[model samples]
Target: MYLEKLAEGKTEIGESGLPPRPPENFDMTKFDRGRKFIQDHVICHVLAMFISLVCGMSVVNLLEPLIFTNNSDTPNKAYRRYISTFMHVTKWYYGNIWEENNKAQTSILTVRNMHNKVRKDMTAHEAKIKNSESVDIDSLNHERIASCPMAMKDVRLSQYDMSLVQTGFLGIVVMYPRFVGIDCTEAELDDFVYFWYGVGYMLGITDKNNICKEGFHITRDICKEIEQQILIPSLENPPSQFYPMAKAFIDGGNIAHKNKLNSVESVLAIGYHGMNVKLPKLSFMDYCRYLFLRGFVIVIYYCPPVKKLFNKIIRHFFWDSSVLEKKMN
Candidate 1:
């Protein structure tokens, strides 16, 4: 029925009949003129891209001084600055490309959390073994506790601490004042700090046991011996130097006690658990481009002469060129 209605309006036309004409006032020239206008201003598209790049860098350059000033009264201001700077830099650099980076961050946190758990469990098992048997494992006198299974687990958990040391070293190297530059904004600087810390956390670099060899080989027997000999003495009068780092180590050890891995399979299980986690891998080329543009903005901002020169050049090239004609004498 629908097809029949459509067919009813159809008419057979003779070749001699005048073809249907477009509206009398319709001007094809208008469409052509519009196309020509766009073709003539192709440089505008390129200029827009340049402007965006410059703006993004400018934001980064402006962030550091604004956030990390000497008067900034926030506690742990340096740490906070690192976190904030990382987020801002990442957002600016990646913007719409943040999903993968976020996923990677989640995975790293998961691994860290699990690593903490295994350490705790191991600590408890070591305590029970030492208290029940009184085997006096410390008297055996081996520099490395390779034979003790609990000690081996402790050693393995120590890998996380080693990871943290590696990350901290890398952070110090990459985030140096000379390396990232003084012109970067507080936000950008914070971003730089956060990026490395986040990467370290994800890579299992912040684990405590792995940082020191003696700490790594801690077993049920060894810990008991240490508590009686070293820790008790320290409690009476803690060393002034290395106190903070030592405290951090003790705290990390406590966390590890809850996360013991008894068997080889358990060890493998913890390692493999976060394997499915994903991370964003931003292109190095894009990051380099971002840095270059940021540097360019900083140069313009810091040097008034360069800014004036840029303005003059832009005026001559674009504004002057866009004028229909020169002023008459």
Candidate 2:
């Protein structure tokens, strides 16, 4: 009947040479309907799979710290670990911030402006000093001595005091303008770097401050003192690479000094600041997640059993409780 219908031209023949029409009252749209149904089902299945993968990965990421521990026997490993972790977290946060707001070009401009302002102030101060006569200098020195009323007391400047002064001066030149209204010129910027390097040596990381204390072995106070006194000063007058601003001060006869400065500069510039510059931006939620993950890891990896038990209770009540509740009910 379908062939006859096709031959009589009452119904159109499909490519398969059968009548295109279904029986009267039949649902002719079933094939289209079935295809639509399958497509929707497949899409839903794919979406479910993707969601499952993401959820699984999140769980794995959360649990990763439990699976690894540092095996190094270095003194103050915990402190080192904390510093390393903080650096990592900071970098992640910094990068993410920039990624989210690509046009946020504030840091560089702020730093440059700060440099310019400090330079201008320094120039003015130098001019004032140069114009002062011998009488004026004597009078100024007398005033300075008079101001130090406690000179006869037990008032030797602490390492901290010196560090504060150095850092403060550098901050005025390099950092103040970024946060405040100061501007630094190229010379001031160089001076800032030189001061910081000196400060770094005083902090005890450099050769000059590497001596061990007499009795106590490497206490936090001792380390801090070393850092403030030794490491900071050693870092001062760094090479051009460490502080590009230092290049302006180098003379031909000061090859050894230049080399030492370069070495220190390379370490600080290429190492410390380099790491600082690469910090990532992170959303608050993401940061919280990272902190939670880190805390979880530290608890598992480093905490004593008793502390771990306490932490577990805290974790259950404070951190993980909501997550578990949501999963269950």
Candidate 3:
């Protein structure tokens, strides 16, 4: 009966015994590109960019809260000191990241264990402080981290400040990509988000404060709430006066561009391009370029043998032999 209907021109296939054709002008190149994308190791390149963003953009937020604090107060002094130590942190990051799958100077498990231990110590210490009711909280940790800044100074670090630093990585890498940044598919973004949330758990982020578990939109909304709820300086509660921690990022970025022959620019550009995101401070032209590149990056995945070549470069730079691996248990 189906064949008879088709023979009588009662079916879309007509008498040809085949499905109807698409319009002649329908570009086969679209389908070809789509097929090529599926065949190519697109996920590998997306992940490479993800790691690259981690290494590169993580520095950008090192000086936040500077706008709200001064040098004398603990928050001001503490955070500036934190940024000053960022170079050392980068060394630890490189070690943790580049040593292939081997145990390294700063493996995830190693730092995670340390973070957990520190959290345990802080809880006990807090109980002691509360019970004593005699010691000033400001005097804890030798007045380094001090109370306030949304984080208390614990055994070693400020819990609130460290929480911010920890979540900053997840925010830039996962949340921004959902709208303003690169073209990560939902699956790739979710996997990356989930991985960091695991790290957050390992690092002792409390259920109350861990922001990375929420999906991207909710996380961003949380960010806006934080910005609003930041306690602005009142006459009674002035910002702690202090020297600037690092130079303003723009000043430092420009100076580095000048002195370093744009090694700084090159790294920053990876975040800029890899995410298809330009800072809002940049011009409309830059956003247009980002939009153009969002589409263009698809071509990158489809290039002949490029995924293999890109993966080789990524391994050479970030996954090769490392001295740090010697310390692994």
Candidate 4:
């Protein structure tokens, strides 16, 4: 029931006739608390971004037709594209979402506009092909068509896919809090879920298809199921595109941040630790680095002073500039 309902979201777009509601409908007090929860956990949030990217690349449903488009298909450009994308996400988390003219509201609306544009572009591409007398769809190689984004000629970006993308942000934190260093009360976690719920609503996710619609516990379960059924399987037997996309994501992030450690070993270390999955064997030094990162993450979570220091560095390095701001201006 959970997965099916979510799958139905692929056909849904727009506001679904629902007003934008923050936390008031569920728990009025959680609104501000929800905002603060995100504000206070910068490092964990960054880790969640890494996990989200890994999960996203693995999901073929999202990649082949939509994500596999020119924007992210190539390594050289994928990182810049994603960095710009997540910078907008960071704006929504940092800005006051409930305020009418706030960055959060503006950013979400902007993303909706971008999505609509992609749909139009894809549809137009398909139309041209269909009208071409030289082309014969029936005679085309099925594999070739399947590998191309042009195959999505008449398809619309469904609500189902958007919600899955939402899970990329929320699921890892909820399901593997320790991996991401999410140290908080049940109430705080609930607040965090509601926080994303509001963001999802503003992003034009229909109320019925909202991943956080059912609140924290149920939504966490839904995220877990996705990880088990879809995400994990895809990772285990990833398609050809996953390597280039995932490598590009890691490489781009490292280069943008001036991070020195983006080796295959580093990526493998994170995959093993964050997702609790067995991967190819690592060298002695690689294993040591993994242990160091794992231990460092634990220290950041348990030691308030250390966590505070890291959060400051994270904000300065990753959040100081907004890519969306540059684009909008």
Scored by lDDT, the top model is: 4
TM per candidate: 0.22, 0.18, 0.40, 0.84
Query: 167 in model 4: Cα distance from truth in Å?
Result: 0.4
Q: Give lDDT tens digits, candidate 4, residues 145-214.
A: 3563335533556677777778888888888777877778877888888888878877778777788987
Looking at model 4, report the run of 10 residues with the lowest lDDT sum.
Answer: 137-146
Candidate of highest TM-score = 4
Give candidate 2 regions above 4 Å deviation.
Answer: 1-104, 134-329
Q: Candidate 4 — which residues are off by over 4 angstroms? A: 14-28, 65-68, 74-76, 135-145, 148-154, 257-260, 283-289, 317-329
1-329 in candidate 3: lDDT tens per residue? Answer: 21121122211110111112222353334433322322233334344333332232222222222322333134334334333333233333333322355333345445545444554555565566567766675353413323224233323333343444554454444444422224457655555444444344435454334555554455555533432232111111322321222223323433534642212233334344444445334445544544554444454545545545654553343336433223221
Candidate that beats the other on lDDT, 1 or 2, i.e. the better one: 1
Local error of candidate 2 at 251, Å?
A: 42
**lDDT value for model 1:** 0.31
- Compared with the true structure, all predictions reach lDDT values of 0.31, 0.28, 0.38, 0.70
User: RMSD in angstroms, candidate 3?
Assistant: 18.6
Q: After superposition, how far is residue 193 of candidate 3 from its true place, in Å?
A: 1.0
lDDT of 2 by residue, 145-222 (tens): 233222221212222222232232223223222221223254433432432332223232221221221111222234
Candidate order by TM-score, highest to lowest? 4, 3, 1, 2
